[model samples]
Target chain A: MSVEAMLQTIKLLLPALMPSWRFFSVIAPSPRIEITLLKTAKDTPDSWQEFRPRPAHLSIGSMLKRMFYNARWNEALFLTSLAERLSSNPTEHSSQEILKRIKAELVRNSFDSFDSAATPHLQFRLVFVHREGEQLQKHVTFISPVYGSFGDTDS
Target chain B: MSLDYAIRLTEILLALAFIQQSIEHFRAPRDEQRLFIPRFILSILLLFGFQTQWVCLALVILALFILRRFQGPYNGGSDRMGLLVLCCLSLINFMPSSLWREYVFGYLAIQLVLSYFFSGWVKIKNPEWRNGQALRDVFQFSAYPVSEALRTWMNWPRLLVVMSWSVILFELLFPLSLMTPTTLIIGLVIASTFHLANACLFGFNRFFWIWMAAYPSILWLQQRIFIVEQL
Candidate 1:
C-alpha cells in the first residue's frame, strides 16, 4: 500500500489506542492501577499487605515498586496455602519452604493455563479502572496456580 | 553577549560535560565494563572534537547558528566535509560488528522519523485537528506548575495534537523539504518545538540545544553559505 493509504488506516485506529488528548494534558495524574492494587491488598486479611503505593509516573523506581508488591502478595498466599495442604501448621513452616511453595504456585498458576511464552515468569495481577463522567472506579483480580507440577502439561 | 561568545561558551560547556562522562565510564565497576564501552567510545569522539578537531566541530556549530540567524543563505565553506568525518567516526566507534552499529544508528533514525511521522499521522487522522481543537490542547497541556484559568477555555487535546502532529510530519519530510525555502522554514519551526519540548519535559537540556544547532544550517542555509560542486 502507498504511504498515504497506510497513514489513513493508522489515523482511523489511533484514537482507539490513545487516551483522549485532554487526559495526556494533566500534570501527574494518580495511577489507577496502583490504587486498585492498594485496595485489593487491604481487603485480603489472610495475606501480608505491607506493599506501598508507588508514585504515578513511568520510571525505573515505579517499575521496581510494582514488581516487589506483586511478588510479596504472591509469595505470602502460596506459602499459607501450601502449609494447609501439607497438613502442617502455618507457624511451623520455614521461610525456605514458603519460597519453594511460592515457586510451585507460580508454575501451577501460569504454566499451562496462560500463554506462558509471552508472559514473564514473575507473578502479576491485572486491575481495571472504569471512568464515568468525572468519577473513577477500580476492580482488581488476583490469579495464580492451585497445586501442580512446574511443567507445561495440564493435569 | 555576542553570538560568537555564546557559541564559544556552549562549546566549552559541552566539551567539559563529555569529558566528565568519559571519566565516569572509566570509573565504572569491572562487572559493568561491557556497558561502558559504547559510552567510552562516544566520550572519546566528543573529546577529540573538543580538543584536536575543534575547528571542524565549531564550523558545524557555527553553520547551525548562521542558518538560524540569517533565515536565508550566508557565505562560508560548507561544513559537509566536517559532517561526513563526524559520521564516519560515529560509524567506526560503533563497528567491528556491523550489526551493533546498524542497530544503534537504525534505532536513532527510526526514533527521529517515527516521532515525527506518528505525531503528524495521528493529527491529520483526527478531525479535531482540522477544526483547531488540536492547537487548544497544546496550550492547556503546556501550562506549568500551576495551571491558569485559561485552560478551561481551550480545546485541550485537539490543539496540542494538531500542532504536535504537524511537527512530526514536517520532521519526517525534512530531508525532502530542504529543497524548498517555505518547506525548510516549516521543518525548522517543527524541529525547534521538538527540541524545546525535550528541554522542558525531559531535561535533555544540552542535547536539545546542541543537536538543534546543526539542523537550521544543514537544511535551510546550505545554498546561501557555500558553493555546491557538481559531481
Candidate 2:
C-alpha cells in the first residue's frame, strides 16, 4: 500500500490499544482507617463516648510509621515475657544465655518509639506472637490517637 | 513543483502523527477526561481524510475566509467584526493556568524570532559572539561523546566562532530582511535550518513539522508559489 494509505489506516486503529495497556499496569492501593472523634457530654450519664465508624484515608508513609511502631513494641513485650517465663523454669538450658542475647539484639534493632527523651506521640505498641515449631513474629499496632476509651475489637 | 505534492506530504505526515497519538489515547482513554473522547474521535476521522473530519478542516477554511474577507477593499467594518470573532474564540478556548502548556505554546509562536533576535542581542551584549569565540564555546560545550576528540580539531574553534557570530548577526537583522525577497529567503533558510537542527538534536518532531508547514505561508505572502497551471 502507499504510505498515505498506510498512515490513514494506523490513525484509525490507535485508540483501541490504550485501555488494555493501562489495566495490566501497576494500580495504587488505597489505605483505609477507622476513626472516632472524642466528645464531652454534660447532661448524659457517660462523660466520654466512642463515636461510630469514621474512616479516614491514611497515606502510605503514615501507615508505614504505624507498622514500624507496632512491630517494635510487640517485640519488646515478647522478649520481656519470654525472659520471665524462662526465669521461672528451673531446668533452663545453658544456651539460654545465648537466646537472651539474641532476643536483646532483636529488641534493640526493632523500632523504639520511647527512648526516655522521645516525644510521647511517637510511642507505639508492637505485638509479638510465639507459635509452636515456628519462628517468632512481630506485628505493630498504633496507640489509637483518639484516647478516652477506644477498645480494640479483636482484643 | 506541484501543490499536490506539498498537500499530499502534509496530509500523510499529519495523518501519521495524529493516528499514532490517537491510538495511544484510545488504549488509555481514561488518561484524558471522558469529555475529550469525541474530540479524539473527530481528530482520528480528520487523520483518515474522512468527510466527517471536515468539522476541524472547517476551522482552517474559516481562518482563510476571515483572512480573505479582511484584506479586500469591499467593507472596512467587516475586518473589525472578523477580529472580534477571532478574539472571542481564542478567549473561549483559553487553557487554564499551566506553566508547561504556556511554555510549549509560547515556544511554538516565537522560536525563530527568539533564535534570531536574542542570539543577535547576545552577540551585541558581549564582544565574544562578535569575535567568534562565543560560537567556539557553544560548539565545544555541544561536543557530546566526542568532546575529547573534538578538542583536538585545531581550526574548528575559529570557524565555529565566525559561524556563531554570523547566526547572531543574521537573526538580529532578520526583520529588515522581510522587506526584500532575497533577504527574506536568506533569513527563512537560516531559520528553517535552525529549526531542522533542533528537530534532529532535541527530538522536537511535532514543532518542527508545524513550523515547516507554516513556512510556506511566509513565502506565499511574497508570491504565488502553488498556483496550478492548465496541463
Candidate 3:
C-alpha cells in the first residue's frame, strides 16, 4: 500500500494518534454553565445558579490528594470543553452532546427549589466570562429552551 | 537513570495515573462510566509488573476506547502525554533490539522537552503573556483557578509579570539544561514543581502524574547522549 493510504488507515483506526501539544498560551473567555428552574413561561425563573460550583472548598490535604485522584476535576475540564464548543458553535454535535449531558446531570441532582412547582422545568445557559481588572464580567452566549427534568427527555 | 529503573518508574507512575483517571470516570452517569474498566484492569496489571509486555500491548489497544469515549482527549495535554507514554512502552517492550528501544525513548524525551519549549515560545510571542495579562486572565477568568480565593493573586500586577517572565524563561531555556546531569536534574525538579503548582491551583492533577511518568525518559536520554559523546 502507498504510504498515504497506510497513513489514512492508521488515522481511521487510531484517532488519538494525532495530537496538538500547545497549551495555556492564550486567555480566552471561559465558559460557565448555569441552570434555572421555571414553572411557567410567565413565571419568572428562579435566580440562576452555577451548574457545577467549584467544590465548596478543596482543603490543602484534599488538594494534595487530588494530584493523584482527580477524575472529578478532569471531568470538569471535559465539561468546560463541551461548554466552550457549545458557546462558540451551537449547531455542532458537541453542543447537542453537552446539552444531553447537562440534562442528565440536572436529573441526577435535586432542583434548587424543593418547593416543587406542579410541573417543574429546567433551562440551562452557557455564559462566557472574562476578567477585567479585578472584576469578573460575563455575558450569556446561548440558552436552551426549557428541558424536561429527565434524562435525554429535554425538549 | 538506568533504562531498567526508568522503565520501572514509568510503569508505576502511569499505572497510578490510569487508576486515578478510571476512578474519576467510575463516578460518571451509568452509560458513560463502564468504558474505563479495561483501562483500570490493565493499569493494575502494569502496576504489578505482571505480563508487562502483553499488558502494554493491551493498554495500547484500549487507548482507542478512551479516545472514542471522549471523542478526543477528555483533558488534552495530559491524555496526549499518557497516550505517548503508552505507545512508547508498547513499542519498547515489543521491540527486541536495544538500539530501537533507545530510539523510542529518544522520541518520547524529545517530545516531552518540546512540549515545554513550544509552550514557552508561544507565550513569549503573545503580547498578553509578555505583559502578564495572560496570567492575570488565567487567575481572574479561567475555569482553571481551583478556588475563588486564588483570584486575590490578581491584585499583584508586578508579581504576575515577574512570574510570567519566570515561566517563559524557564521553558525557553529548558533545552540547554540537557547539557549536563546537574542541569537536567535541576530542570526536571523545577518542571515537576511547576506541574505540581498547576495541579494545586488548577485541579489539573492528572497532568502532574502523566507528565512525571515521562520524565525518566528524559534522564535516560541525557545519560545516553553523554555516553555516546564519551565513546
lDDT of 3 at B66: 58
Q: What DockQ, on C-alphas, does every prediction get?
A: 0.03, 0.01, 0.51
Range of the 10 consecutive residues with the lowest summed lDDT in candidate 3 chain B: B64-73
> Which of 2 and 3 is ahead in TM-score?
3
lDDT of 2 by residue, B80-118 (tens): 222222222222234454433233233322433443465
Ranking by TM-score: 3, 1, 2
RMSD of each: 17.7, 26.4, 3.6
Model 1: how far is B162 from its true place, Å? 6.0
Global local distance difference test of model 2: 0.35
Docking class for candidate 2: incorrect
Per-residue CA lDDT of candidate 3, range B81-132, in tens? 8988988888889777988888888888898898899899989999889998
Per-model interface RMSD values are 18.6, 29.1, 2.6
- What's each prediction's TM-score? 0.34, 0.32, 0.89
Give per-residue lDDT, candidate 2, residue B188. Answer: 83
